[model samples]
Every structure is written in structure tokens, then in C-alpha cells.
Target chain A: MPVTAVLHTETRVVRRLTTDFPALIAPDETAVDVTGLDINLSGGFTVLELDNSLRPASPEEALESGVDEAAAGARRKTRHRAASVALGAAAADPLSHTSLREALTKLRLAMYGE
Target chain B: MGLSVKTGSFVTETATGSKAYTGLGFQPKVLLLWSVGGVTAGTFRTGAYTSVGFGTDSTHRAALGWSSQNGQNFSNCARTQGPNVLDLVQWDVTTHIRADLVSMDSDGFTLNYTTVNATAKIVHYLAIGGSDITSCTVLDWPCGVATGNKVVTGVGFQPDAVMHLSIGEPSSGSSLQADARLSFGMMEAGGGQWSNVIYSVDNSGTSDSQRHQQTGKCIQKLTTTPSVNMAAQFVSMDSDGFTVNFTSVTGVAERVFSLCLKGGSHSLGSFSAITSGGPAQDSPSLGLAPLTYLLSSFNSSGQASPIGSTRWSLGGSDGTSEETAWANDTDALGTSASDTLSKTDKAIVICSATPAVLGEADHSALGSDVFTLTWSTVPVTAHELLYWAIGAGAAPAARIPRWLPVMRTHDPRPLDAVA
Candidate 1:
């Protein structure tokens, strides 16, 4: 499953410095889950157009890519830790619900491939 | 190690002092700032001042600034005055104030300026960060009174893009009354496509401003007669920078400041507005997804649609902030506003007296290597649009297998069996 985090946007921008992973802000308040990507929120936002290949994959993807189950689990743990911190940071802001909605929607798609 | 960018604004100190803009998260390799001085009350007029600087450290850097004085007078600091990035003065050159980027720090940069003139200058800046940038160069060239190509070289590498400013020496000495031009030119590496907007102010009697915009031209001098009516075009992207061909010229050598870039994916070209069929238009394929883009419009023959009007826009996503600056002779005014609905394709350019949308388009979708420009209202006649796009780098051509087939940890067969 994909990890989740809320992101705050100022003028629709989320600073990359606010998160550990590469973050993509949603176009609007409507949260979007671009699975394999990271999230966060802050100011001085510059939209970054990233190469899709570099995105981080879920544990299932790691295993599918031929990694051992233990290795995939380790990757999951790392992602979880990073997401937890990002989530806490974004949730602290009252204006992060839309970002959260986008993030949750992305997470749901990643989890169920919906 | 690829190029990354950040945009923000700051107000210059009322008193002469040093200040730092921190929290950028990455050290910037180059900085470009345009004065938003006219937006607030007691502020300077917009486009009156602009600056560009480069270097990772203060000790080994170069900077330049160009400003237009109200009486059709102007001045520029080109790597002189000890590394200062800005030199600003009031309508007349009285208490000349200066500022410098003294340090380029890990997280941000520092600026040291002079004097509290009561009114502070609000500056908008774009900072480019990354180690992969091959070079960031500043060039000050002269556009003399003669019609010919003025090829600018010495960048040391084929630059991907360039920004130009036109500052001519005052026809009369210290009095500083004459014609000055504030120009912005965008040129791409591929095909040498170019587009530019030149705003010239002639303070002969009253403050008279002329807007000269063109799609296929670069550095141009369009002041009233006897002042060198010059028009230039992009020649080629040379190995050691690029070249410009000034087809028409006359007058003393006018100074031009250029900030050139090397190492980054850049796409620049022009397209015409649709007046037939449908209102949908697509820019020439950039071959990559762009992070930011600038679009400006001109007439079919490379002049403003209404002849004496001006319009240009800069846009990017993040909640999508689009900034537009427009002016016309009737109003004799220039103003900018932030539009949140701006996207890669959904941006418009207008040059009406009321600044109504002569041509309106919204970014419909960003494709793999192209974006769709869906016009809300097509122009009554065809207009030309010049656009420049910057990308972090090219996208991967295809998804490679995430991993080569690896042997199972508990594989019964020998590891070398498959090999």
C-alpha cells in the first residue's frame, strides 16, 4: 500500500524542503495520490517536473521488481517513517484538508489500484 | 544535480543595509530579479529596474542591473562598482542607491543595498539552483548605429537560453535626458527561434513609452527617428554561446545586457494564433515536460496588435501562479496581477487599451512532450506567440524493467547457472 501525508499549498505550491521525498502538489485542494511520490507543504514553491521513473514504489512493487520480501519490508518501513513525519508536518496546518484529500485519494488508488 | 528553481519577492530596505533571503532550501547558481516597484503605494514603477547575477560565491561572481529613469534617462551597472547586483535611482538620478549580492549561501543568498528613501522597491526574483549547470554567464554588448548582425560570443559553451536588456548612453552628458529601452528577449538553442518585447521610454517632452514586440526578432532599438531603428534576429546557437543578427541599426553603440545559460533542457519557438477552424493550438513539441514557461504575443508583422500596447505573461504550476504585465498608450500605465487558474496551457495574451483578452487560451493538458493550448476566443486576426520552456531534463523514453531478474535467495540452482 502507498504511504499517506498531507501537504499544504501556498498558491498551489508545496516546497520540496518540507518533505523527505520528492513531492508534487495537487493542482487544487482536491488531494491527488501520485503513488511512488512523496509529499509535504510550505512556501517558496517551484513546480518540479520529475522523471516518472525515479518515483519510489510500494513494498508490493519492490517485491514485484524481484526484491526479497525482507528487503521490500525494509523499504516499506523507511517509507512509513518518512510519510509519518510529513503527515505530521502537513496536518499541523489547518489548510491541509484539500491536500490530504488529494493524498488520500492517491493512496487509495495505490492500495487498491483503483 | 539537475537544475531546480524557486521564485519569490522581497522589498528592498528603506535604509541602505544588507539583507538575506533565506529558507530557499538550495543554494542558487544564478539569480534574475525584476522590480515590482509600482504595485504598492509609494513604490517604484514596474519595469523601471531589473538585475541578474551568477556565481556560487561572492568572490568569483558577476552581476548586472538596468534601470529606466523617468525623464527617458537610464543607467546600468555591468560588473563594476564592486560586485553590486542593483543600482536604483529616483525619476532623476539624485541619491543613487546600489545593492550587491555579497554571498551565495547554502540555503539562500544575501543582498546589501543603500538608503531608506521612504518608498521601498519590491523585487520579484527567480533563482536557479543545481551543480549540473555548465555555466551561467553575463555579457554586456553594444548595439551601435548601423544595421548589421551583432553576434554575441564568449559564453564558453552553447547556451540553452538568454535574457537581454537594452540600455543606451544618455545622448547628452550628466543631464541624462534621452531615450532608454527596457527589453526582454528569449532565445532557444534549437533552431535559434526568438521572441522579444521592447519597452522604450522617450523623455523628450513628457514621459512617452513605446511598446515594440516581435516574434522572430531579438535585440531591437525602436526609438523615434535619428535614434537608431534597429531590429535583430537569432543567428545560431554557436558552440561557445549564440549569435544575433541585427538586420537594421543606427546611432551610437547602445549597451545590451545578457544572461545566458548552458546545461538544461530548453524549448523555445513561436506559433500563430488561430482565426479559422477551431481555437485550439499546440506549441511545437518541446520533446520534454517543462517545469516553467513564458508566453508573449505580437502582431503578424512583429508589432503590438494595437500598435502602442504591451502584454506578456510568465506561468508555472504549484497551485498555478501566473503573472502578467500589460500597458497601453491611453492609460500610460503598467500593472501586474496574479491569476491562480494559470496552467501550462491556460494562459492568454492581450494588448487592448482596457487590456481585454484579444486572444484567450487555457492550458488544457500537458502531454508527454507537448501541451495543448485551448483558446477561449480566437483572435479576429492571426497573432504570433513566442514561448520558452525550461525543464529539469528529458523524461525517460520508456519504463525499463524495474530490476534485472535476480536469483532467488533460496534458489536451488547455482547463481551462475542463468549466466
Candidate 2:
């Protein structure tokens, strides 16, 4: 099952339980199925707050959420860097180039309202 | 049966209700729980607290819990009723806002709370499971009763280890009071004893002073103001329970709670060395491989300028997983703090999750029965370090003697050829 919401309580932060664990595992919800393997919940896990969810969060969901947050931050930084580069180029050789002047006008229109 | 130990954490339920924590493959015979500090709603008391319970069922178990608050003055409260995990703002045990272990079930355990409206906090627990756990009991001793050795029996079996905690709510309020003393000590058979005690005096609730004493004695009460001197020294681990000698004749009837653990493969001992910020050195052998171990250190000089410092770490494997906490009082300031990173450099650290964070020492257990410790940074003022270790693992097989068979003279068997 996929984890929907991370429960942030006053005491601890809870996400979803996963098979793999880091060296220091924060305690989580109890009871793990021990059908085929000898491992138990003692390996350490995170708690996922659900109305009735029991299964753990899948790998794909974890990866997708991690990548989504990283990519979103990168995209925002990239746009800010592009705007700074354009402004720098116009300031350097604005009087000599007609293309640069036209580009600055378009850039200004995109950045500002009118 | 062999021993199995598991560590985990959980958050107490907020609403009025009970919760059972499962997933422990086997039923635990003994459970040790502590309050791991975290952000919480409402005015929660911030400090350290611990509780230990032993039993297979609810009615037959025994538990003792105590908490220490290092605020205006060091205030401590203890309860003898099952293992109760108190919420924040609960310095008084009379309040119904607490979590108590109700029963030890087949898989995990259950906790019943007084009210659901109390603030929740993170609790870390270590549970031990095995048939070798023959006896898990608690003993209470009235301090300053007499000035002689008192043997504590009725444990049924010699305990492998014991934990001591002083019970009573000693506070700092309107009057100049001198009752609050919080001490935590653990000792393992064949190993060393380590304990940290903090004694504070509330003078008119305005001016307060705390004495952080690190001594071999698990339960010690010594103060200059109001002239109170007493120490409950752990004499030895005996055939049944143990023995404690009281060194004072008169003092408050402060009670001491002890949790005795018998069974399992445990090695307990202490070593002494000077701090020079050196390489990793192997500790004296424990004679058997250990899966996990706890290391504790204190100044050998007893109480002084850095009045009795106590530092300890829990470590496992290539020393990668480790947790360290320390409490020390700088006599000049008359202030003491535990789990604080700034004052760690003054003392030596054996092992830490973040070695750089402590910047004193780091420790890792070797594959064999011994572990290695290294001091990352030399102390500004060098002092003797008394390190105590308690290692737990599978019990080793008993040794069998080899006897030489008698050879008849007529047989003419060579001495070297005897089987």
C-alpha cells in the first residue's frame, strides 16, 4: 500500500514502514507479518497514519515522492538562474545589439505584467 | 534458550484508550523503557526518565519508573505502581495523565493510560526474550536505616545485572529544601559498575545549586548544605540477590528501587586509563562475542572541579550504530546538564553516533569478546578515565574436562601414544 499522509505529532514524526532500515531506526507502528521470513518489526520502521492502512509504502512511491520534491526545487532554481543570466547579458552589451534589446523587452513582458 | 533483544520506539495514544505494541516475534520476559525527548504539545516536563518491568502476565509483574527535571532546580518524581510513562507537565504522580503497562501478551505488550487528553511523547524500549530469564524482580531499600552491610535476598537466582533508581519527588520551591536526588546506575556480573547521580538544593526557589556526582556507588546521597551525607554502595553480586552497605546513620528515608536481571550471557568489568586522544585500543576481553554493549565512563578522582562526570555510549557492529549521553557539573558554575553537546569535550567519549559531534572519543565493538575505543580529541586538562562495560550475547558452552586413561604396565603403551 502507498503512504498518503505523514503524521506529524508533538512527540515524533511518522512516515511509512519499509523493509530496508537505516542504522538508527525511529520506532513506528507495531506488528509485522512473519509468514515466510524470520524477520519481525524489531528491524525498526516509521508509522504511517491512515484511516485503515496496514501495508507498507512501496519503493516506487517513495522514489517518486523524493524525486518530485528534488526536481521541483531544481526547476525553481533553474528559472531564477535563467532570468539572472538574461539580465546580466543585457546589462553587459545592451547598446550594441538589437537582438539583445528585443530579448530584454520580451523578458520584461514575461517577468512583469505589461 | 538463547537471548534475543529488540529496540524500538512508539508514541503514546492521545485519546483515552489503551494500545498494544506487537511485532516482537517472541514474548519478552523483561522490558526496559525510557523517555526519549521530543517536541510535544502542552507544558511537558523536559528531562530524562526510565522504567523497567518484568513478567509474563499483568498481575505478576513488577515495575519502577522515575523522571528527573533539570529546570529551576532538579526535581525528581518516582512511582512504584507498574511502568508508567508520564506526559509533560506531570511532575506530580498523583495526576491521572500517564501511561502504564497493563499486560505482557504473547507477542508484544499493552499499555493503559489514565486519560486520553494527556500530551504524548516518544518512548524507547528494549525488550529481552528467552527461557534463560528465570528471574526478573524489583527490590526496595530504605536509605540511611543503619550503618552496615545488608544482604538483599529472595531473587531466587543470582542476577546477571541490576539497575538502581532513587524514588521520591524532591522539588525546589518556596522553601530551602534538600530532598531531590536522582541517580541511575547499572551493574553487570563480572563487569564494572557505573552510575550518575544529580543532587540539587532549592533555596527559597530563587537560588539553586546542583551537584552532579559520578561515583562507583549506584545510589549515593551526599551534600554539604543542611549537612546530609549518605551513600548506598553496591557491595557484591551474591548467590541470591545482592548486598548494599549504607555509610550513614541518619538522613531522609529516601527509598531506592532496584530491578534485578538474572540469566542471559552478560560480561561486566571496568578498566582504567588516562586520556591522551589516542588510537582505538581493545578493552579487556569479555571472553565471549557480544552483539551489543553499553560503555560508561567517569573520572577516577571522584568529585572535583568537573565534579564527578559520567559519560556513556551504546554501540554495536563496526561501531557504526552508537548512542551517547553524558552529565557533568562545572563546579565554578554549579550547573549541570545531560545530553548537552557543548560540555562533552571536557569529558572523554567512548562511542557516539556522530563522533564529530562529541569530539572526544569513539568506540566500536570487535568481532571477538573485546571492543576498541579511541579518543578523538585530547582533554584540555587530562584526567583518569574509568570505563565500565556490559556486553550481552549468547551463553557459551560449559567446559568439559579431558581425562587421561590409566595404562596397564603389561600393555607397554608409550606415554606419547596414550589416547
Candidate 3:
């Protein structure tokens, strides 16, 4: 019989549910107005103004703000270190297909924290 | 998923004037490319799988649509291999897309396409509204002539559009000749919009046409009599000058009187004495000397203030010695020579009298120098009656008998003492 480690370590999986997705687009046909948002989300997530009062934080936002303090800081440092490594790899081997993909993936992981 | 595949940038050019695109190995999706003078390149794509080529002989090009042949790989389908024609190419895709091609070399060129819609031509004039005509060679239309309002349909090099003008009744009391200056011009009916074309109808000088000459009734006959009797008298015998004292009535100040011999029938020199008396004689004389000199200074309101004193010499060299003597006496007595005497000689004597008194004398036969002495004296003052000595000599001098009340009698008095 294989012994399974039944030790329950707390692993937080924060989920933010958003049903009104179209509201992510600006109501005005022209450029978006994001002055109300405290955090800029256009880099990755499409920030939405769903209702006047309710604005739940997204998954990306939770990961950014909800991690354990020391671990969260380590993760941030690790992400910055990974981005710098990927940029060095891209510069060294720009034409190498493998290096390009690896660098792009690292960059995405750093931004989205996958 | 088995294999998701995408294909790209396959270009083909045709030979000069070759209208049909024939065999290229695999029926790869076709995109036509054209280059003009190695400078410009244009591409056109035929949606999915298709092939294009130029016919060896025919001018019309062909775009062949292909469905996959059984068991055929994408490579096996015909593909346009290299470049095509080296000259201009034109094609019509469906109905609306029309394109023209120019080929520079084996590798480059441009395709120009135009989409067109059908339209009709509209004609326009230089001056849409009308043109203003200042003068014209022919004065066919005159101003103020009214024509029935109509749309300004068209205009010509010369003013066209037949116009019916109402010349209105010929200027009142004027003869209507064919050649008169009949005013005629186009005008919008109802609205007083005048036409830009105005002209005068003159009968080109050959015809007898009269221009409008303004005539009016002789200025209302001014039968003005001196408000007070004129101080000067008309004398026919002596030809001695006289003094005229003109006192204007309140409203009569505006009246201007010109003194000239009436018909040129008689010879009388210009005015010698023109003095203005006051409102009433007792009010004092507003003497107007050299009336001609002061005519311009008369106030526009017609107020006759004292201009200055004026005197007429009765017995100067222009008169006989007796007249001269009379004028001297008159000057001494502070009386006008014209007021007291008829014959120049006695006029001198009477005018010279101290405390000049009225005189009586026969003045009937004083020949051609017949004169009428007229004047208004001071309102309430006592005046001695005076007369003229009729004969030439100074022998029998005449005197006026009674005291004449001022402003009363129009008779002449002499300077001789009464019996």
C-alpha cells in the first residue's frame, strides 16, 4: 500500500467571480477612463466597472495582495530575477527558437504569477 | 487537432498582354502582384484556393477557382511560381472592381483599381445670380419698368429673357414720342425687387425726343409793398437821386426786394440810398447804408438790425445848381432832399433851410422828371408841410400852408415862407 501524506498544508486558491464581462470595455466609444481604479489592470486583466458600489478584486489582484508576507516578497523577488534572466537569454540567443520561447514564457509567468 | 496550417505571401506576375493565368503546379491560394517601374507593388488575393495565369494569346486574363482534387496535398495543387508579365494589365473582378496593371521588371509593378458609380452632368453658369449692367450699347430697358415676377431660368451672353415692363403713365403732361426717354427695365412683380438691367430708351439721336425739362408756375407773384410806405419817391423831372427808407414788418424780413429799372424802358441809376427805419418811425431808423454792401450780412432769420446810415445826394454835379443848393440845404436841415422838393433847385433850398419848415410851390410842370414821393413819418411827431418851387429861377419861392401831421399826408411841401 502506498502511504499518502495526509498532512494538510494551507494552500490559498482565491477565486474572484465576475459575470458582467462586457462592462470591462469602456462605456464611451472613445478611449477608456480609468481614473476611478486605484490599480491599473490594462497590462493584463481587463479592468471593469461593473456596478456603482461593488468592485471585487480579481484573481491577479488577490495573488498580488493576499500572499503571506515573506513568501510574497520572495515571489516578487523571484519574478524580477526570472525576468532579468529571460532578458539576458533573449539578448544572447535572439535567433534561437528555444531561447525565445523560454524567455517569453518566463516573462508571462512573472506578470501573471502562474 | 491534427495540424492547423496557415499559408502566406505567394506572389505571381504575368507576361505582357497575356490575359490568362495557366498551370502553376499546386492550386495554392492566389494573390496577384504587380509592380510599376520597380517603384510600386500592389497585391490582390483570391479568397481560399485559386490559381491565376495569362493566356498565351488572348488579352482577357483568367482567374481559375479550384476545389481540392481527391488525395491532393497542398503542395501538389498548382502554385504561381515566379513573376508574370512585364507590361500593363487590366482586369474586371465581378462587376464593380476594375483594376489596371503596370509592370516594371520581372519582380515589381503596381495595380491601380477604381470603383465607379454612374452620374449625370449638370451645367453651371459663371454668375449664378444676375450680372449688374452699368451702361449698355443699346438702351432697351429702362429702370423702374416692372415685369411679371418669374423664375430667373437662364441668362445669356447678352441680357435675354423677354420682359414686359409697365412704363407707367408717361411723366405727367409730357408728350409721348416714340423716342422720348421712356424708362423701362425689368422688375420683380409684387415684390419691389428691381432688376439689375436698367436702361434708358433714347431714340438714338435721330428722332425728336425731348428730355424732361422741369417747369413750374412763375414763382407766386410777389406783390410786396413796403410795410411802411417806401421813403424814396419816383421823380421824373429832376433826375435827382432819392433815399428809400425800408422798414420790414416782423414776418416780412425774409422778403428780399431787388430794385432795378422795371423794363429797361427807362434809365435810372442803381439804388443810391437804402436805409432801414425802425419797427415804427418814432422807434428810430435802423439805417442801412450801402444797402448793396450789406445785403449779404442780412441775418438768415431776416432780422433787420441797424446796418448803417445811407444818404443820396440830390443836388450834386448830377443835378442842376438849384438841385445842388437844395441838397446842401437839406443836408443842413437834417431833412432828405427828396422829401421836400420836386425841382432840383428848390429841393436844395428847402433841404438847406434852418429848422426846415414845409414849403408850398407849383410843381405841376416839372417835365419829364415826374416823381412820386412816398414815405411814412414817425408815428406821433409833428411835421411842417413842405412843397416844391416849380420854376427854374429862385424868384417866387413857395411855402406849404398848414402843419401836416406825421405819418398822415402823402403830399409834397415847399420851402417858401407863408403869406
Backbone N/Cα/C clashes per model: 22, 12, 66
Q: A86 in model 1: Cα distance from truth in Å?
A: 74
Query: Interface RMSDs of all predictions?
Result: 29.3, 25.9, 54.4
List, residue by residue over A60-105, the lDDT tens digit for candidate 3. 5434532122243345446656765766556467576886767666
lDDT of 1: 0.47
When 1 and 3 are scored with lDDT, the better candidate is 1
Instruction: Compose the digit string of candidate 3's lDDT tens values, residues B369-393.
Output: 2222212222122212212111111
Best by TM-score: 1
What TM-scores do the predictions have?
A: 0.56, 0.54, 0.11
Task: Report the lDDT tens digits of candidate 2 across residue range B1-419.
Answer: 36655555566677766788998777877665544233231112234333333343443343433333343222222233333433322223333245556766678888776654444555545567766676776665555444457687766668877777653322211111122334566665643455555443221122222433344455554332211134555677799888866543222355555778876766544444334434344555555565445544443334432232223322222233343333322221222232322121112343221222323555433446555555555344433333333334434444111111112112123223334
As a TM-score, model 2 comes out at 0.54
- By lDDT, the candidates rank as 1, 2, 3
Pitting candidate 1 against candidate 2, the one with the higher TM-score is 1
Q: DockQ (Cα-based) per candidate?
A: 0.01, 0.01, 0.00
By summed lDDT, the worst window of 10 consecutive residues in model 2 chain B runs over: B399-408
- Tens digits of per-residue lDDT, candidate 1, B330-366, equal 2143222111112222355443434355556665555
Candidate 2, residue B177: lDDT:
18
Model 2 clash count equals 12
